[model samples]
Structure formats: structure tokens, C-alpha cells
Target: MWKKTQPLSHEDIVAIYDVLLGRRPESESVIENYRRMGSAAAVVRAIGQSGEFAGRRMSSPFHHYHASFDAQEVMRRHAAPRLEPRDGHLTNFLGVVIHSKFLPGILGDRAGQVEDIPIPANWHADIAEWGAALRAVELARDSFTMAELGCGWGCWMNNTGVAARRLGLKPHLIGVEGDPGHIAFAREACASNGFAEDEVTLFHGIAAAAPGTALFPRQKTSGMEWGLEPIFNATEEERRRALAAGSHDELPMIPLDEVIGDRERLDLLHVDIQGGEADLVDSCIDVLSRRVAYMVIGTHSRQIEGRLMDSLLGAGWNLEMERPAIIRLSEGAPLTLVDGVQGWRNTAR
Candidate 1:
């Protein structure tokens, strides 16, 4: 074991990178750079900021390991909170201010008080998503532009926008949501965070491969609804049955091209459209490769994740980070219990 007070040897530095970052150093010079840092703690701190470390944190099976690198601890060490939390409003580890009304069914009782919220826990989002989103913002030059597909309450949009703004870059946020009520919440979130009207634009529709109509759930209890995906290319009988069931609403399907519009470059594109994620991405791979700088996707199943890899890797995009979907045997078949996350960077751009 290496002592914290002593300078790490070359072997110790290599081991630390392998264990913490899941990879060896790029070159001997890289190891020498860490060696110059002297202490093991400094090396660990530097590794913690790396994209590989972020990926490893997301993919770790142990919850405690993930919690150790929580945003709260990171913020306390590096960046200070931009706004103080009040009774009805709370700031996350990233200094993004969120209103309590947006918490409701999401955070449950923890949303009641600002003090009750656990900053160390991944209550709303995982570390990989935060890392990928922030990495995109860090890569932005003059301005930061991002779009969130299936943007429930505009969570990623507001979170990333605030992060970019904190870095002194102007943010242009775009959000698309099938649920009208959720769109309203997203609008409220932007306003509550003090974003100018021109800085934020919201679309009330579904994001898909093509322009058409799809069936989306008209959720009665909007607060309790999540992971809702639109059903596309439904037959007449299926549409009739769905309408008769009184659960789904026919909504306009906005294609990726329309959603992208004339933006020169999008800093980030966050997608979490349930199981439809892979298909939507595959259909828009060409456009995405040219326009998007980075993507943080929510994967629902092993199959969806595989499809994404094939499509994106073929398109020359680099898989910067990934946390595979958690699969468990259920009645002699594999079923995904929790959603996985993947962060891709556009190498072509």
C-alpha cells in the first residue's frame, strides 16, 4: 500500500490510474506528470476530474462508491454554490436553483425542506449524466446551445444551462416534451432560474425519426408520471383501442431535423425517450454527427444499448462514458430493472 504523505512511485501512479480510472496512463510522460504532483491525493483528485473516472463511477455496482464522488463533495471542494437555498427553493451541488414545486412526486418528502434534501445522494440524476452534460458545457467556445428530447420538466436543459452560465457563457436552451403539463413545468423552471425569454424555447410535442402523429399518455397525475414514451406508427385498430382506453392522446411528432433547426452547433443533446431512444438516435445519426457535440442518452434495455453502440460507433462518434442497463433474470428471461446511461462525443465535430 502507498502512503498518502509520500510521493507516489511510477508503479503506484500506474496502479492508481488503472484502479480509479479503469485504464493505464496514455504515455510515460503522463505518469511523470502525476509523479511531479508528488502526493497520491493530488493524483486521485486529478483522476476524479477525468471523463474515464466519471464513466467508472457511473458503471460501479456499489452505491457507496458512486456516493463518494457525489456532486455535493465535489462542489464543496472546487466550486461554491451560486445561490443559497431557501424554504421553497434549493440549489443542487452544481449550483442550479430549483423550486420545490418541481420536486413533488420526484423527490417525495425530501423536497419538503431544503435541509432535508441530501446533497451527497444521487436523488434526481446519476453521476454519469452530470459528468457528460458538464463535459459538453466545458467544450463550448463562444456560447452554449443544447436541446433535450423527451425533456420532462426541462431538467437537463435547466441544469446544463445554469452550469454554462456559471462559466460566463450565454446559454440557449431548447426542450421538447409530449406532456403539456410537463412543458409548463419546464417553462416555470426556466423562469424561476432567471433565464431570459429569448434564451429558452420549449416545444410541446414528441421527438421522433419523422414528422407525423403519435399516441402519448395524457397522464392525469403529471407529478407521478415519468418514462412515458409516445407510440408511433399505430394502426387504426390500435389507435381506436388506445383512445377508447382513455389513457393516450394523439400528439404531433416532430422530427429531429425540425428540432435541430438552424443551430450551427449544439453543445449537448440529452435524450431519455424510454425504449425509443435507440431508434430515434439511429434515424438521426447523420444529422447528429454533423451538429451535436455531445450526447447523454438514457438506455432502457440491453438491446437498445447495443443498437446505439452500433449506430454511433459506425458514425465515428466516441463513446466517452457508459453505464449499462441493470438486467435481472425474471421468470427465465432477462429484464432491465434500471435505466443505463451512455455519454457520446462527436469526434467528427
Candidate 2:
């Protein structure tokens, strides 16, 4: 809904294009480099298009992978494509961001490469079908709230927030990020793009379990800064830490009763916490029993394979697994998604 303003005078135009970032030296250098290399147009183009960073590695110098995984492991295993388009896939999302001129590597990524960094958590909803669902919800509801468990670079979060609003709902967005630096990036990117800070609540820390509860997990990934994708770094310390943390955040750990405190508050839940959805399920079993009206959970757990399905059925949520990732990547440990992804809202209970 942001109509391009009338063309400005040369002086005014230059003043407007002066993008000043208030964060870090690298951030400033990034902006400066983009200006010097005349890549503003290129950057904008990348942001406006979907999967623009498809093959781009996140970390420059190609050392991010070496920081964790072996070179052979990187090429052989993670190099294989694990993604396929789905319902909510935003074809021109990156394009939109570029048009908005706010894509300066908002995620923890040093560069805007998708591969070197990881896919932001909310990117799980990037399926084409998910896009349709989002549009449908926008057409159906007057307003809605969209919160991301771990919003990376704020691209997905910012894009979806705009979509939610465009869908006609008064968007109430909560982006819970562990790293304050990334949180600041998210805050700036969204605010610079004509969005009010109030529309998006960018938290500098993790979302507390409830009022007084604090999750004591170890790892926190901000999201993808790709280009050199297929992130494979066997020697990376982060990978070691990730391995050490285990199923706590990056693995499947929680039961159902713990995560879902509000049974009917969340209209749509997008859980892309590595493999932590299982733990969330394990923690807030009842949440699956009630709270969420629609969901787009990314499965990484094989033990509770049918856990989400069972909980949804028990709660009377008739959802069909839309994109089954037809090509099985993992031995039954593939990424599964849902669509029409809705739950019954009972007012007479």
C-alpha cells in the first residue's frame, strides 16, 4: 500500500538515497560498498525477488563451512537440494524488499548470501501454497497477528508482516531474536521501510516461556544470509555448539505440555526452530490441542513423527499435509509441511 511518491528534485533524491545505518562498522562498509560498486540496484533487485540468494553462500571468504563441517561433507551431503516450492512461496518477496530498499544483510549474515548463512526460521512459510493460504487468510480476516520464533534478517518477517497487513488484518507482529544485534537490524530494516515499530515488536532476546519463565537453551541462529548456500561447515565452532546443545534448540527435545500455554491465541503458528518443533510439541501438547487456528510447522523429529498430526486430529483440526517434500532427503526424517492449515475456533466452549 505504499504508493511511490512523486519524483523528487535531484538534490532531494540524493538526500533520500542517503541510507545511513546506525549499527556496526561492517554494516556501514556494506552500505558504502553497495554505493561504491553501484550495487544498490542489484541489492534491491535481489531483495525484491524470491530465492534470489538461492545459491549464494552466507559467509564471505567461504570459511563459514570450514568453521564447522569438512569440505567433503559440505559438497556431498548438504549440497543436495532439500527444498521444493509450496503454497506460501513468495515469488517476488526479495523483489519487494529491494523495492523497499531495506535489505542490508539484516540477519547475522556478514554478506547477503543465502547459503553461507541459514534460512531464517520464518522462511518455512515460503512455500507457494503457504503464500496462497496467507492471501486467503488476509482476504478472510480483517486483521491478524504473525509472530516468528526466530526471525532471520527480518526479510521473511518483514515481508510477511507487510503481507498480513495487505491481507487486511491489523498486523500484530512479534519477532523474538536472541541476538540483540540481529534484533537491531530487524528494527532498523522494518522501520526504514515505512513500517512503524509498533506494528512489529522486535525483541532483543528470546521470548520468555510465559511471564516469569525463561528457556535455558544454548544456541540461537538468526537466519540466512545466503548466496553460497548448502551451508556445510564441519569445523565451525557454532556447529560444535549446535551439536553440544543437542535437541534443546537445534534438536528434538521438548514434549507437548510445555510450549503451548495459550490454546486459541495464535492464529497461525510457524515453528522452524531447526528440529525444535518436536520439543515445542512435547512441551505444549495442549497448545496443539487448542491455541493455534492455523499452523505451518517444519518437522525435524522422527520419533514424534505423527505427533503434530495426532494432536491436531485430537483437537479436531482438519489439516492436510500439503507439501510432503516428495523427494525424501532424510530416511523418513524429511521436511513435512501443512496447508489449509487451520483449526476450529470455538466460541461456545
Candidate 3:
């Protein structure tokens, strides 16, 4: 049976480490650090700084263990020897080496199905079109500041970063994510991929209309929804229920007005906040219209698609490229196409 784990206290951490290291902790020092930091994350940091934990990098044991467990489970269920970890990484259906947990055939049940088609291959033409659109918006020749909201695991960031670097553009990348698990994985990936901490700044929070805490849907039914829309704009009733039930967690929500700040120009803003991009964009029209030079948005619904098109068009932005909306099918074929990933360039600015 799955048992709920309790929060670890100062004494618990000290006692656990005492047993592991076979030595007693300096009680006064441990208590002082605990009081100063006042969180499990801080306790982990303190442990990393100690002589015993030297060279250990502060990587969470929970993260590694969970990744391993998920990988093994996926491999076993799918009976996919090819999907097994090779050289310490799983080459997913997209041919992208994912160093984290992955679920095989999550795209579809049968091999060679439309969903089984690797993403990079299936979207190769669209990718070219997207690049062309970016070039048309004058991103090809200039250094730019790019921001990605809901940047899960930094895949899009890595792709864009490499492209920007190849173009001799000094890309200032900022990623905003709501999931703590993703935040940690992205940070590790950035480090492993040789990205300087200063080059790619990441904030562990959801993008919304304001900078504050809000109740988020912490319980997920699958991994696909990990970086999906968070319920930051919850109703009073929903908030009350969440608070009473204590099943969900509240996370920091940052506004785009605050993210863009006093910067004279924002070269590109890629929004893939699951289904919440409309709310985020709608909330910061003034800043987005005046400062953002280009944008790529992933619309989750026709309503969201219409709203984005109307908003950007009203703001004097030109639509460069777009995919039309798609409907789901319950028959012989899968709904392989979706009308999302629209591109726009601000011409008025």
C-alpha cells in the first residue's frame, strides 16, 4: 500500500544523517542552520556544504530513484528493448535522448502509428516554416532576448538556444515553469548541457496576471500533463475547496508585466502554458504589445486560438504562420493534426 509521507523535521534530518555517516551531528550547529533556513531544501543545502557531503552536488535521491523506477516500469510494460536506457539515457520516439523518466507508446498503442511517428520527423516541415517565420521577423541576424513560459525540461529552449548560437546571436534565455520536478530536471539538464547558470535564468513558478501564490492542480493523472496549464486563476469556491481538502499545492505566479520589466525590447516570447496562454497574454496586453517583437503561442482550443488571434491582431502584430484547429476522432484514425503553434511578429513597434 502507498503510505503518505510526513514532512521531515530538523531532528529527523540530523538523525538520518547521523546514521548514514556513522557520526553525531554538532547539535548546536545543526539547530542553528535549521532555524536559519527553515525548510527541507535548506537542510539539503546545509548537508551539501558539510565536509561529509563534499563532491555530492546536492542532487536529490528522491529524483534519481523515481526516474529509475519509472523507466523500469515503462520498459517492462512495453516490452521495448529499444526504448531501454542506452549509455545512461533513453532515446525516446522523437530520437531525443531523454535522461529522465519516459513512458513508451504514450503517443499511441501500436508501433508505426501516426502517433508513433517521431515528433521531429513528423514536424520537420512545420519546424522549417517556424524558423522561416522567425527569420522573417528579423530574428536571424540580430542578438535577441527570448523567454519561454511553461518550459518543460527545456527541450524547446535547447533547440532554440542552439539555433540562436549558430546564428551568432547572443541569446538571453529565460524559462518560467510551474512544476518543481521539472524545474530541478531543467536545471540539471542545463548544467549537463554546458549552459552557464547566468546564460539561462529559470524561475520555478507559473505565469499569470499577478505575482502571488495560487492553488495549483498538484494531483495529475499522467506525465503528459506535467507542464500543462496550472489553475492559477481559480474561483473563490475552488480556492476554498482546495484549502479545505489540502490535496493541491499553491505555487508562485508571476505576471508578464513583471517578467518583461523595463527592458526596451523583448525579441521573442514563446508561450506553451498548456491551455492557459490566453489568460496570461490577455492579462499583459500593454506590455506585450509595446515590448514583445515576436511570439509563438500553442493554442489548446479554438476559443483560445480566436482570442490570441484577436488580441495580437488588435495590437498591430502580423500573423506570420499558424496551424488550424483540429478535432478529436474516436474512430479508425487518431487525431494527428492540431491547429496550434501560431507565430506572430509585432510590426507596429
lDDT (0 to 1) per candidate: 0.71, 0.38, 0.54
Q: Which ten residues in a row have the lowest lDDT in candidate 2?
A: 60-69
lDDT of 1 by residue, 1-349 (tens): 0112234578777766765666789999999977765444345545654567666664443132222134333333424444466556666665555665654533334442333222212445544556656777777888999999988778889878887888899999999999888888899889887799999988889998788999998878664456666788899999999999998999899888788789889989998887888888888888898899989888888899899999999899888767666444546775554466788889877
With a 3 Å backbone cut-off (N, CA, C), the pairs that clash in candidate 3 are 324-339
- Count clashing pairs, candidate 3: 1
The runs of at least 3 residues in candidate 1 whose Cα sits more than 4 Å from the true structure, single-residue gaps closed, are: 1-79, 111-121
All candidates' TM-scores?
0.76, 0.47, 0.61
| Top TM-score model | 1
Candidate 2 — what's its lDDT? 0.38
Compose the digit string of candidate 3's lDDT tens values, residues 1-349. Answer: 0001233455545553543344556776766544443333234334544557543423322112111122222222322234333453444332334453422212222223222222111212233224422443245346667777877666556545544654567766678877666766677656655567877878878877788887655644323344344666688888889878976667888788766666678777878776777877777888888888878776666678889888878878787666543323326532212334577777855
Model 2 RMSD, rounded to 1 decimal: 17.2
Order the candidates by lDDT, highest first — what do you get? 1, 3, 2
Point out the worst 10-residue segment of candidate 1 by lDDT: 60-69
Error of 2 at 175 (Å): 1.3
Better of 1 and 3 by lDDT: 1
Q: What is the lDDT of residue 116 in candidate 3?
A: 28
